[model samples]
Target: MLEDAGGHVRDADDDQMRLECGVFGAWNVAESSAITALGLHALQHRGQEACGIASFDGQLFHTERHMGHVGEAFSGTDLVHRLPGRYAIGHTRYATSGASVIRNVQPMFADLEASGIAIAHNGNLTNFRALHTQLVAEGSIFQSTSDSEVILHLVARSRKGSMEARFIDALSRIEGGYALLALTNECLIGARDPLGIRPLVLGELDDAYVLASETCALEMIGARFVRDIEHGEVVVISGKRTLRSSRPFPAARARPCLFEYVYFSRPDSVVNGRSVYDVRKRMGACLAQETGVDADVVVPVPDSGVPAALGFAQASGIPYELGIIRSHYMGRTFIQPTQGVRELGVRMKHSPNRQVLEGKRVVLIDDSIVRGTTSRKIVRMVREAGAREIHFRSASPPIKWPDFYGIDMPDRDKLLAARKTLAEMQEILEVDSLGFLSVDGLYHAMDAGPRDPVHPQFTDHYFTGEYPTRLLDREIAEGRNDPVERQLSLLVTA
Candidate 1:
């Protein structure tokens, strides 16, 4: 049952790449709702637009979704009372495949003949549009526009007798990168996509089993990390906490998203047995090796840029300093600001530190430049703070192509790197010099050897446009299908 709750929605209006969602689930744990809430807190960095939790109190499923952060949505212990259960699952959403509305907030629940299930998904299904069209033609009603809801309808309409069978049936029919959590009355299930383009970790907390998008979530709830849920693997944790595993898809090389290291995963988290923080540091060191810049100080853009800047400074033998201070409290849309004030967008989140930047040749390091709007503003801010010269460095390679998996990125045409030459980008950002880490450098930093031309070690498609899965939705949308299929699609819409 869905519970109406109050929350403060913070809209995102930035150039940073956004992960679609984060999923967390706990089985056979005391105060499972509370445990799930704690895990969601750690995964909140993955998504911030909406959050929800669904619990099964042995007999009934209780759910509460709010349009905001997990901390605000599930703030009080009263939530423990409202969602009493030892089996629970939660999701934090940013909406890449659906509108950011309360209705689309998940741990999307459905009552089926086998059981009541709540599924929380991270990443997008490339075949969602086609499947959605087919499902609608079959008279299945959908509550949310989210591609994830299509999974529910598929499972519901499956001919399979068991819940696990039906769930696998749904997964087999969908295509794309996804790490999913499903909580049913009998068991809690966790599965990762065939290529492992996304991430999910298995953990054990006392007598209970846990699953989350990142290991940081396991750490947050003091769970012992057992292992990563392997590519194309499905793990089912029974009500009695007995665990079983299956691989329902063909074996494939794991190609986890490279952005998890470059920007997405929490620095403290371990992804695929690699420390995210250490990998980012190596990325900076590689970038420094590739494009060393002479400067008075290496200044990070703050937060996400700090680790890479430290690595750059160390590698280049340049001193590191805090050239920009970020305000944590600044909401994207705090209030209606005038046009002039809106134009100073970066100033709301970041302020120049004159003491560090004044009269110095500054080397500004950032994770990556998306549209380059924020980079230009930050460059102007540093210049206004009396920096004599500014050289810009991006730890990750220029993102020339858009992502279709889960990262919310602008189209290829809108990408600054996609359209502009290196010199043009330098001139546009008004930086004395600009350099981006080479794609090979990124691979070296991740300790993945060189990127394979035929089979990449990681999903570096945002930079390389070598997407691992077929983009069925994009193909249909771009009218790249057979004429017969196009006619059928048009008729379906009509």
Candidate 2:
């Protein structure tokens, strides 16, 4: 269940760490809003809390933002008709920065002296609190608490000559991961951060140019996948169908989030030129090699674990089976507003199949263990189903650090691996054994060989605690009377 700004609770079960948002934009296309809606639908797994689309016709900009799934918000409505335009951008939000309020929904719009602009962002800003505090002190009025709103304020306050200049100016001052899509009357703009921590891909459909969080969005609209937007590069599609490219930031090595393959992105999506499904399967194969266990059957914790289980079974030469049946009708238990209900919701979502596990020694493959609460419950369920012995395998390395960029990871004290050893975790989960893929093993699966201790290839702070960007918020979080930390602790669980 989720709680909106109105303090009302609703059933929702998206338990994974929340991705900040998904963004899509198209330039010089008929019924641009409809195209954007389709793109957002394809990228729906990235976020599910709220969604919005903004389109710019020759005369005016039209917008529709709502708090719900993309299909429920955009299907069979005159809302598309209201947003007639040749250029548009859309966002699906998961609320990492602000409260679950209607005002916080994106395609955040602003009317500046230069022109009216609407922006949709896919990652978090690490220096948001400092910027927000400064902006508020300067008499800027904020419509919502979203960090993406800070970009608008920065652009509006810039002394730059044109909209593009102001936009670049705003991006330069910000630090952290971002894949941004902006729509204006004359152009549609797409940008990736200097480090390329988030993903943004370019695509082509007839005469139109497309920018989306993943290639799946392009596939949904029958667009041909182009290349990924380069780190620090900006592409602008003008009204006359002219495409211009610029590199505004200094050159830096790309480091896209590794978790996109492990859990966040849909298996069908391709990120940074690598197939997500292929990478996940490789992760499972690597896990099997790292710690191959003796078990009668390899069982997967349904859905997300399916691909990994296949790879594990293939590598270990053990038959794979669906030992846990997940109920698609059940909502994600993570969104349950209350602790009691959240725990109960897990049982409703998954059940063990006794027919597959009567007397077999089962090896269970899962993506990752966050708090170990759900894993513990799943182990108990398997035990009750008469499994002779249980062994748990995790596809990714131990998640020891909190994700400040976007993923809603628990605090250090709350993470199972952070507080306990591997043996301790096995005992706690009541499994015969527990194994996690090492950091180097994860890199090997990506075909990148072992990770460079001094210069890693990807942003994997969740496991390594080696953040790619400066943590300005960490300073505030460490303060004696820090409201930011308190608020984060409360909002993170929600």
Top candidate (lDDT):
1
Model 2 lDDT tens row, 1-494 = 45421122423333356577899999988888889999999999888889999998887888899988999899876755888878889999875323678999999999876689999998888878777887798899999878899999988988888788888988887878899988887788899999888899999999779999999999999999989999889998896668899998778989989998898888998898899999999998999999899999999887888888889999999999988999977653245567676667667878889999989999999999987878888998899899999999999999898887777666676678989999999999999999999999999989988899888999999999899987765666566436665454323210
lDDT, residue 395, candidate 2: 95
- Tens digit of per-residue lDDT, candidate 1, span 246-319: 99877889899999998999999999999999999999999999999779999999899999999999999999
In candidate 1, position 289 carries an lDDT of 99
Task: Give per-candidate clash totals.
Answer: 0, 4
Residue 157, model 2: lDDT of 81
Candidate 1 worst ten-residue window by lDDT: 1-10
Candidate 1 ranges beyond 4 A from true positions: 1-13, 96-98, 483-494
Best-fitting candidate, measured by TM-score?
1
For each candidate in the order shown, give its overall lDDT on alpha carbons: 0.88, 0.85
Give the number of colliding residue pairs in candidate 2. 4
